[model samples]
Target: MDWDDLRIFLAVARAESLSGAGRGLKLDAATVGRRIARLEETLGAKLFVKSPQGYALSEAGDRLLPHAERAEQAFAGAEEELSGIAGQLSGQLRIGAPDGCANYLLPQVCARISDANPGLEIQVVALPRVFNLSKREADMAIAVSRPTAGRLTVQKLTDYHLSLAAHRDYLSKSPSIGTKADLRAHRMIGYIPDMIFDKELDYFAETEAEVVGLASNSASVQMHMIQAGAGIGIVHDFAIPFAPGVVRVLADEVRLERSFWLIRHADDRRSERLTRFAEALGQGLRDEVVRLEREAAQSGLAPP
Candidate 1:
């Protein structure tokens, strides 16, 4: 019934765990658990179903979610109005994206935003899975595909390039890869087929290459493995330039292009901070893609 208790419930619902919600609320796990319990007692209904995986919203919780979100938006609007009077942005803005973008791109974009709004706190979650807006996993997300359904807003950020790449040493010592057929003979590094969260991430499906022998769910790890000369794998065109000794293989013969989509929950769309951050973030990503494409063009690589 209390606003504070509802806030805790929202956090817990979003995070799916005691520690994660506690971290966001800056409260200990015990306090969060106690508050949730008190809220449940007041309503005389179970709000969450706890399991080994995490907390899931119960039937009652689902019924309460929309109303609670409306209250949250009301608070956010009032806060934004006040912050506007002060001429600054404040509070946390969490952006989630695939590891490839998160590791290679978002840090720079976030830094610029932070410099402009010192009062704002930017939280980036470099996830391998699709971001769930319905669960409020992230305030915004840079995704490969737009959501087909949900109370969500989607925008096309930009299209970027990816291609098969490997370390020079690995290419030299390994079998020749003059054509796509040769990829079958080489050890390929990529996301585990079963663990791929999005269909867009199923890179192997686009090629004749068999199941990857060296696999991981983390893009960072897959990139590192390629750089370490483990095997040939697909990599972002923008990121390969930074990895010494790594070079694009069959640049023309094997090229993959994917677009990034920006997504946010409709409920939070009115928040000034979220709106400003989305604009800045999208523009920043577009600028970065342009720069990378220019660099790739100069190198006579894939058409960026």
Candidate 2:
């Protein structure tokens, strides 16, 4: 079977229309339709059911989805490996991480990668949820939880401390937070449900209010809201450095720490872009942790 035909089918399947996929490939609709037909013939199965609405996957196509994806991924890695011999590391890097860590580190990481690998295109997937490496949702995942099962290549990336922070204005307006009780009296921004947060390390606990004034699934956005004076929120020690309007109120007293894991499928060792991106992330996080430790020491505040 022609690899391009399967790729053409995948594109059409995703786009849900010949015309849409055609526009993407800079081909006319007739060409797109012909390619899909050729692919279906080669596969000896109807991949899509054409309707007035759009093309939807057929039963055969649904079954072939995983196979198609794996084939493409393997082909990409093989091509990159050969290309790298000519001093070129070329492919897309798909990465997912929690909002807390991404807030400070993502920009610098992207800049460094782009500068070093001109042929590589980095696709940063910043979602409210952590992408599962075991499920192959991403090329690599920087997860709060350690991978328990799966053929995973996991590394303990770094530990980060969390602290209660708010805009300097909020502290000035509200009474000072000298004690835990003082924190209960003010408005607080908090994360929404079963997100990737440390529970045993006790980074988070039920506040005095038992409810939050504002909530978000994203730690970065929640931290930004706090800096925007939305309210005090739990933020990592590293996130605070980049936060403009925020300051630690009872910094000397409170802290929360969690481990970040750089994870990928063990099989992904063949992927050049994935491996390099993960290495960059691990090194960057370690460097940031050192910087944060220095800042915490200068402040005479106990590290969270």
Q: Please state the error at residue 20 of candidate 2 in Å.
A: 8.2
| Deviation of model 2 at 79, angstroms | 2.5
Off by over 4 Å in 2: 10-34, 48-70, 85-88, 132-138, 146-155, 192-209, 265-267, 296-304
Name every residue pair that clashes in candidate 2: none
- Provide the RMSD of all predictions against the true structure, rounded to 1 decimal: 3.2, 4.5
User: How do all models score by TM-score?
Assistant: 0.86, 0.75
lDDT (10s digit) by residue, model 2, range 149-236: 8778888998877777788777777766767777677888887656645443234473444557888777778877887887777777
Cα lDDT over the full model 2: 0.73
The residue-by-residue lDDT of candidate 1 on 1-304, one tens digit each, is 7678888999999899988999989999999999999999999999999999999999999999888898888888888777762566778788999998998888888898788888889999998878887777788888988779988889999999888888887877887776788789989999987898888888877667885879999888988999899998988888876677777878877778899999999887777778877999999998988787667545543112
TM-score of candidate 1 on Cα atoms, chains taken together: 0.86
